[model samples]
Target: MKLTKEERIRLTYQIGDIIEQKCRRCYYNRSDDASFSINICAKCPTGQTLRQLGRYFDTEPRSRGGKTGNMPDGLTPARVRELNDQGIPDKEISIMFERSPSYVGKVKNRWRKHRVMARAESGAEEVK
Candidate 1:
């Protein structure tokens, strides 16, 4: 089913998240309060573009392109070291932990600088 600009924008962002509705021509008319309805945002850029393009328009939140997630819990430094000590490859460990291989490698690289890690590399037990 087709969605209106208000519906699409609402799907992408809540009314409170649309605080930065800026345009030189429509700046004064733009709604700044979360109290007002989405229709008050009609003068904003997305609405203006939608006005010009009609159904051919495609819109997504401007900030959606950036990396915007928190690191998942449990993939701690101790956990990573324990996984590395288990003879698991970084790729497999990453898959098991639901993290990227590069992130796992980065974690391992950061941990490698510890003197205990240096000793552990020579068969001594790692001190966490």
Candidate 2:
């Protein structure tokens, strides 16, 4: 599962592109100067992704103030998958559970990885 340097760079750029697109849709304000600030809503998908990817700096002031530091106690991986299966987008699901969208995305990603691993194991069994 280890990625080569070039693969890692490519993945990073792709993620950045996705984040940028989401930010643009969310009406994030970007400044031209180096000392300028990029103002984004705290609950925005772009903000969440940037924070998760470690591209967000602590010095930047958020438009929506700060994180409330409240964790969704009852949200589990199964619950997330159920919501997603029911046609709920990750952003809406996160809002419903009072969590960051990146958290929901991570949960979904984990489930996907689990399913992929399970399928691989089942295929191996079939080959045997």
Candidate 3:
């Protein structure tokens, strides 16, 4: 299908963004062409377009071009405890643990509520 002038311009900008992101976060450096190369195609022997290259890599954070960074590598129990001990905020810790920051934040919030409830119950017992 033929693309209109506007479509072509949009497509070009989209492709350029993909290329830049890929270059920034490329995992495999099989060849120099795969990374740090100004022109992705010139390095690729298969003649794949920038769009195709985006598929080979993982997605980045907040990327607009339908791509994202690599899958998160969930947090471990030991690491979670370590983060708690360090007094690291749940959201920041979650990112380090490769889990959703929101999940960590929710867990922290729940713990806070539980502590408050326990304290209230204890206070009532003292009054009685």
Candidate 4:
């Protein structure tokens, strides 16, 4: 199921258009219960949030003035998913993903709890 180059370009342009339009509201505002594609959090474009996110990106070395480090990876939720899917250890994932190990641990913990809740809600009992 590989996409041709043209398909990849088209999909990328479409995604860019949606992001440029700030389509977050549309996703959340939809009335139907069908799940919408997950995206960047609603609080995007905020300096405070972006600053908090500095730990995630492999940007530049942090100065004494408290700037983001030179972590080019620059943390994104997609990267989190990818690392988790690859079964990478949290410590290694933290380094490779340019994030704190504790932060990675917390994300994994939260995701685990959420999955458990979903399974329970769907009437699936875990086998001991």
Candidate 5:
């Protein structure tokens, strides 16, 4: 996953192309579905991902200008996933995060939900 500087620059340009060509229509068009409705670009998964990538290239972090010093782990769902990927148990993650284990479980669900949302997919896969 590590990329050279030139690769990063190329990737950023590619993402710009995708947003301009593929994701632009979704941003400007209206839709009956709440998930894809107009003005939902703020919540667009592609935009979210691009913004995250931009952060890596920025010299300074942008302050969200929200209330500060909240949550032990900054309430990042990705951190939860990172711990999970390390095969850490939910209970341990919860204790480290100073949140309830059930809350940790819910974060996991939300993480998966956003992932599915990003794909614009429907119809759950059936598992036997």
Candidate 6:
């Protein structure tokens, strides 16, 4: 479809904003075309024009809100404790839950501490 001059200008600005926010950091050196180097303040006519023509030059695919760095869906603290109880290593649990190993370790530690505190409280109640 043919875009009017104003529409073209708006599209260019939008593409430039996308490049500046997303592409500049991750995909700046990925493009073999040396002339396509991203500069946030500069007007990138070639990049903008290509994007205006419905071509995606960004490195990452545009998906549903992109990648979520947190734990995967359905992986709860109870599930983590169950996995740990079943002799699953933190690294393996992290992989299974799509979270970092450190996060799994922290969860395990927190659970352990909670259990210890609960035992101490129960023992005090029994003595009283």
Question: Residues 57-93, candidate 6, lDDT per residue (tens digit)?
Answer: 3335658853454546655555654676799988998
Q: Runs in model 2 with CA error above 4 Å?
A: 1-71, 111-128
Give the Å error, residue 46, model 2: 51
Residue-level lDDT tens digits of model 3 in 8-122: 6777787777667665445444444445565444555333667464453434344465333333454433344557679887788877766787866654455355553344334
lDDT of 5 at 58: 68
Which residue pairs does candidate 6 place in steric collision?
none
lDDT of each residue in 73-97, candidate 4, tens digit only: 5443445555667987678877776
Q: Write the per-residue lDDT of candidate 1 for residues 59-110, one digit (tens) a residue.
A: 4434654354445566655565577689877788778868776766765675
- Candidate 1 residue 67 Cα shift, in angstroms, is 4.0
Candidate with maximal lDDT: 5
Better of 5 and 6 by lDDT: 5
Q: Of models 2 and 5, which has the larger TM-score?
A: 5
The Cα RMSD in angstroms, rounded to one decimal, for candidate 5 relative to the true structure is 18.3
* TM-score of each candidate structure, all chains considered together: 0.31, 0.30, 0.27, 0.25, 0.31, 0.29
Backbone N/Cα/C clashes per model: 0, 0, 4, 12, 0, 0
User: TM-score for model 2?
Assistant: 0.30
The whole-model lDDT of each prediction reads 0.56, 0.59, 0.54, 0.53, 0.60, 0.57
The Cα error of candidate 6 at residue 11, in Å, is 33
Candidate 1 accuracy as lDDT: 0.56
